[model samples]
Target: MLSPKKIRHRKTFKGRMKGVANRGATLEFGDYGIKVLTCGWITSRQIEAARVAMTRHVKRGGKVWIRIFPDKPITKKAQETRMGKGKGSVEYWVAVVRPGRILFELGGADDELSMGALSRAVAKLPLPCRIVKREEL
Candidate 1:
């Protein structure tokens, strides 16, 4: 799982997802990309899984760029514990993803290879996503 080397804060409040992503909405590093179509918290585990799938599918023929980082800490209390005892410890990290955010980009691969790899990656993600090209931006 992805985590910060050193975090200033251990726990944080659940923030709201207000709008579509304005930044990182376009592909900057690759000709093919995966665009997030829904707002949700993407866990580091999921990200890694998707990355592995993509790389394996592409046979390492292309370069991949992960646009989002799992920097936000998510806390969870012990099961069956009391309701109130301050916040729980940080359990995992997540990236707050919004609609229009480009999560992954692939370069150096042909159209067919990129599409196959990206589609495999999409299956590993929790939210619905669509494959896009740099020209589509």
Candidate 2:
């Protein structure tokens, strides 16, 4: 699983999601990428699963770039626990995803191979996503 080696705080507030992602929306590092169509939380486990699927499909031939990181800590209360104790303990980390954010990118692969690898990764994700080609310059 991908996680930060060190974090400033153990627990943090849940931030607000308002607009489309201003940053990380463009494919900066690959020829083909996965663009999210909706906003949601992407757990580290989900990211890892998608990466595994993509790598396996490509047989490690192409280079992959993960554009997002799960730095936000999500706290959770125990099951059936009484309320009013305080904020729950940190349960897991999630990458807060906004619409139009690019999640994964692939380079060094042909169109057919790239699409096939990306499709495999898309199935592991929770949101609807599309494989996008890099803009010609």
Candidate 3:
């Protein structure tokens, strides 16, 4: 799982995740990428799982880039614990993913292999995603 090695804070409030992604919407380091279609919290484990799937599918054909990181910390009190006992500990980390955000990118791979790899990555993600090709400008 991808996590920050050091952090200034341990616990944080659940913030809002609205509107489309303004940053990281276009492909930067790859010819093909995966664009999300919905807004949600993408866990670190999910991101790693998707990356593993893509790498395994593509083999040695391409270079993969992960555009998102789970910087936000999610807290859980405990299993069946009583409420009102202050905030819980940091349980996991997540990335706030909005529509149009590119989560994964592939460079140097053929069209078929890259697409297949990205599709396999998509299946591992909880959010609905579509593969996007870079448009020459």
* Winner by lDDT: 3
List, residue by residue over 14-105, the lDDT tens digit for candidate 1. Answer: 99997999999998999999999999999999999999999998896999999999999999998899999898888889999999999999
Clashing pairs in 3: none
Error of 2 at 136 (Å): 2.7
Measured with C-alpha atoms, the lDDT of residue 67 in candidate 3 is: 100
TM-scores, all models, native as reference: 0.95, 0.93, 0.95
- Candidate 2 overall lDDT versus native: 0.93
Candidate 2 or 3, higher TM-score? 3
lDDT of candidate 3?
Answer: 0.94
State the lDDT of candidate 2 residue by residue for 1-137, as single tens digits: 98888999999988887789899999998899999999999999999999999898888689999999999999999999999899899888899999999999999988999999999999999999999999898
Off by over 4 Å in 1: none
For all the candidates, what are their Cα RMSDs to the real structure? 1.5, 1.2, 1.1
For candidate 3, lDDT tens digit of each residue in 86-133? Answer: 999899999999999999999999999998999989999999999999
